[model samples]
Target chain A: MVVDKMLYNLGRYVNLLRDAIARPEKFSMYYKETMRQMDAIGVGSVFIVLLISVFIGMVTAVQFVDQLGDSFVPSYYIGYIVRDITIIEMAPTITCLVLAGKVGSNLAAEIGGMRQKEHIDAMEIMGVNTAAYLIMPKIIAAVVVIPMLVAIAAFVSIVGGYVSTVLPGSLSHTEYVLGLRSFFVPRYVFMMFVKAAVFAYLITSVSCYMGYYAKGGSIELGEASTNAVVVSSVLILVFDFLIALLLT
Target chain B: MIRTENITKTFGDNDVLKGISTEFYAGKPNLIIGSSGAGKTVLLKLLIGLFKPTSGKVYYDDVDLFSVDDDALREVRMKLGMLFQGNALFDSMTVGENIRFPMDMFTNRTLGEKEKRVDECLEMVNMEGINDRFPSEVSGGMQKRVGIARAMVLEPKYLFCDEPNSGLDPKTAILIDELICDLTNRNNITTVINTHDMNSVMGIGDNIVLLKDGHLVWQGDKSQVLESEEAVLQDFIFASPFLRRLREDALKQRHAHD
Candidate 1:
């Protein structure tokens, strides 16, 4: 049943895509609206991202230093580990997970409300291209904003991890900076960016698909939002593994 | 004018509209009346090209709506207007913006011209000076008025209203019915309204279509409705006096709250 529904949803998305391209004027409206939505989701989510990044960095740094000891790997490796983990995996995956919790849920709620009130139907009746006007903007916003957020998460996490590891005498600040710069690979950064962008699409598109189809009233809207977050988050994890395996 | 031939809609095994055929003429309010679950809204959707019939055709003038490509259907839709059951005003936009929405999408009008058109539409619905206020800030009746204004903003050739008076007070509902009727006559637009309100039935139902168990049971004017001795129609009209009074009282309460 789930696979069937997912296929059905994929068909609907294809239809919506066709509708959007067929009407370029509607694409302009979607761009503006999606930017508006992206601001709501990405900008509004900054404080929580900062908090989570800080704690994650502190914990990861402390755990690495304690486990590695002094001889096998120097405490300076803490910064490299933080930078490498964040750039390659932690930052994009965690940021998307958080977005799935925050922005994804909100998208579902907003679109579900529109559906319940017949606002979407009203747009259709007015000869307005609803997919372009409503869904496209969100897709554009997600594609643009998620990478910026992941970058922020990586920078903040490294800084926080440095503070935690170097300040506690496990590693000196000089050694940490040296270890961090010793093996900097641009390929990993590029991969991380690609992951962020793909995850962003997954989060927004799935949330929108669920919300757009939501029927009934407030209760149904709530359920749809919850379902959007859950489904999108799982897809993010699965897609992350596939990307990691392919890149590796 | 709109015409339907052998229009049928089925969900799974349940037939919502069973081979129903009807024609709604231009320049007047053509209403569909039926008991709850009688598929009146389904019929309206089919007429307006929102939902394709399971096995039939809907013709607007000479064009078969279902036969056309999506672009052509959209072009047909551009000439259409609709007032939804919940008033379907965009919550994000204020009254003026909502009214100007259609113009923004399909017209090359300047901002000043759009504003002017918005003002004109608001004035038509007796809604002035609240252009910047969001839908949430307005009363339900006012929201419906804003919806009507938005619908008529395009000067559409075809106007479809589904339960325009559903949530309004008796007075507001009557006012809306009168406005729709007057607008149809003034614009000579083809106006189709789906309603269960007997008051609307008697007030602006220049042409009436009645449905029962997914079939077109009767179609005529108000006089024919009043004079007809159909048992089902009689039962439906008279069986709900208490509910109507309850609704009136609720409408009064809503007005008082607003």
Candidate 2:
């Protein structure tokens, strides 16, 4: 049933895409709206990313050094581990998860409230395509902003790893930077970029769908918002595993 | 300018509108009145093409609403305006922006031109300086005015208002009714209003269609309604306690004089 529903929605999206192409004005407005949405989702989330990333990097580094020690795995390997795991997988996945909580909820609430208040109906009556006016902009913004957020998360986690491993342990600071570059490969970095982009698409589309179908009143809207986050988080993980298997 | 012929709508087993037909004239306030659950709102939705009639046709001028393609239907809708029961103003936008939304969607007007038209519509609704306020920051009456301003922003030839005075106080309801009537006359737009409010029926009911149980029981001007001796009509008309008491007092006075 779920797969069928998803297929139906995909078909609907294709139709909307066609409609958007036909209406240049709606398309232009949708593009502008997407930029505005990116600011709200990506730029506004910086504070949390900074606070969480630094600590995550620091802690992951500590665990690596504490368990392996200077002789066994060498403390330098901590940087490599942080770079690979954090950038290629953890950062993108976790950032989107956080966004599912923040952005997903906000999207659901906003759309649901608008629906409850009949603002969407008003738009339809005015000949404004509500999908183009509302959903397309959010989709555009999410696609643009989610990747940047993943980059920020990657930066923070590396800094955290440094604080956790280098600052606390006997490992020299120079070794940490060297270890990060030692195992660095073009493919891994490419993988991280792909993962970030994929995660961004997953989170935004699911959230928008939740917000779009939210019915009843304001109370139901809140429920829909929470449901959006939960659903997006699960979908993100599922997509993450599938991508990982494919890449491997 | 708006006509529905044998329009019928049903939800599952429950029929909401049962073979209803009505014509709403341009340049006047056309009122649809009924008791709760009498399908007045459903009939209004059918007129506006929000819900496709199950077994009949709704004609906006001569175009059959249900027969059109989606693109054509959307184009037809562009010529329409609606004031929803709850005002339905975009809460994120200021009053001026809300009014300009239709113009933004349907026209290639410059931002300056849009702003000018928004200002003019707001001014016409007597909402002069409140352009910057959000819907949440406005009173019910103010929101209704803003709704009206937004509805007429595109100068649509057809307007549909579903219970414009639903949640307002009596005096506010009167004001909104008058405003709708005035706008209808000024623009020569075909306006259809659905209400259970007696005040609305009397105030701007240039042509009134009374619905009972998803069917059109009667339709006539306000004067014709007053003289209607139908028992169902009387039940609704003299149903008011105050009017009933006044009738009783007048009867007693006549008996004493006799």
Candidate 3:
């Protein structure tokens, strides 16, 4: 029974995306909406992503330094390990996991509120194609902007690694820089972007599906928002593992 | 006119609308009234093609709603407008922006033209100016009027208002009824209103359809309401003792004078 329900919902989610990905009824209207979403999703979320990324780098560097402190491992390996872990796993995965809470919850709440308020119904009556008008712009904006955020996260994490270690004299700046430049594969950067884009699409689309089908009253709407975050968080982790398996 | 041919809808084992057929004439206020859980909303949604009937047809003139393609259905919908019970105004937008949204989506009109149409719609509802205010900044009555303005701004051929006077003072409710009636008459639009407000029932209910237990129980103009012998109609319309007494007294006075 549970598996049947899950399959039914997955089918519905796929259908909703199919409808939402249609060519918009009007280009100008959709363009304006896309710009608005870009401002909301991109410009609005930078600070949180940066702040968290900095701390992620700091924690990884500090822990690795302590772990390797008693061993014969070189101190410069701390910078290399932090850089690799952040780029390969921490940056895209952790940042999007946080966004699944912040941006994901916000998307679900917004669309669900509109559903409860009858805004979606009103738009439907006007022949505005509510799914496309509401969901597509958001998806477009998130996919384009979230990768940029993940890139910023990766860069800042390296800087944070530097600040935490070199400032405290745990390692020299020259050694840390040298470690960062070591074993830098351009393919890893491509993998990071691929993960960021995939995660961005998952969070936005899943959250939107939750919101678009939300019915009943405020309690139901709140449940939709929570479900969006929870579902997106889980999907991000599952995809992260899959991407790792494929790329590595 | 819009016609329904034995429209029936069911949810699982529960029948909400049971093979009901009705006609809504144009250029007048056509009302659908019923007690709570009588399925007025379901019928209204069916009429608007929001819910497909299980085994029947709804025709906007000659076009069978269920038989048409997506583009054709969208064409039919483009000529439609609706005012929700809650107004459904976009909270983040100002009154003018909310009213102008449909035009922004569908028309190639310049900014000046859209603004002019917005002002004209507001004026039609007797709510001129205050376009800069958000929906939260307005009174409930003002919000209803704004909703009416937005619904009519596109000059749609069909207008559906779901409980247009749910939360308002009696006087304002009557005014809103008058405004909707006036708009209907002027535009020659098929205006269907689902409402429980008594003043709206008797004042502007030029064509009323009453449903009970998912069946069309009684239907007539306002003049026939008092004279209606259908117990279900009387029971539902005059459910309150005070209104029943007033109705009886008014009938008695009329008979005495005759």
Scored against the native two-chain complex, candidate 3 gets a DockQ of 0.82
Put the candidates in TM-score order, highest first: 3, 1, 2
Model 1 reproduced share of reference interface contacts: 0.74
**Can you tell me which runs of candidate 2 are displaced by over 4 Å?**
A1-28, B244-258
lDDT for each residue of candidate 2 in A29-132, tens digit (9 for 90 to 100): 66667788888988888888777777777777777777777466766787888888888777888878888898888887887777777777777676666766
lDDT against the true structure, per candidate, is 0.86, 0.81, 0.92
Measured with C-alpha atoms, the lDDT of residue B230 in candidate 3 is 96
lDDT measured at residue A126 in model 2 versus the true structure, 0 to 100: 68
| CA displacement after TM-score superposition, residue B249 of candidate 2 (Å) | 9.8
Candidate 3, residues A69-177: lDDT per residue as tens digits?
8899888888899999999989999999999999999999999999888899889888878889999999999999999999999999999999999999989998899
Among these predictions, the greatest lDDT belongs to: 3
Cα error, residue B47 of model 3, in Å, equals 1.2
lDDT head-to-head 1 vs 2, winner: 1
Task: Give the alpha carbon lDDT tens digit for every residue of B1-258 in model 1.
Answer: 999999999989999999988889999999999999999988988887878889999999999999998778889998899998888898889888899888887888899999999998889989988999999999988988898899999899999999999978999999999989998999999999999999998789889998999998888898666556777776676567785576457557867998
For candidate 3, what is the DockQ-based docking class?
high
**Candidate 3: Cα lDDT at B24:** 96
Q: Which DockQ value does candidate 1 get?
A: 0.55
Alpha carbon deviation, residue A125, candidate 1 (Å): 0.7
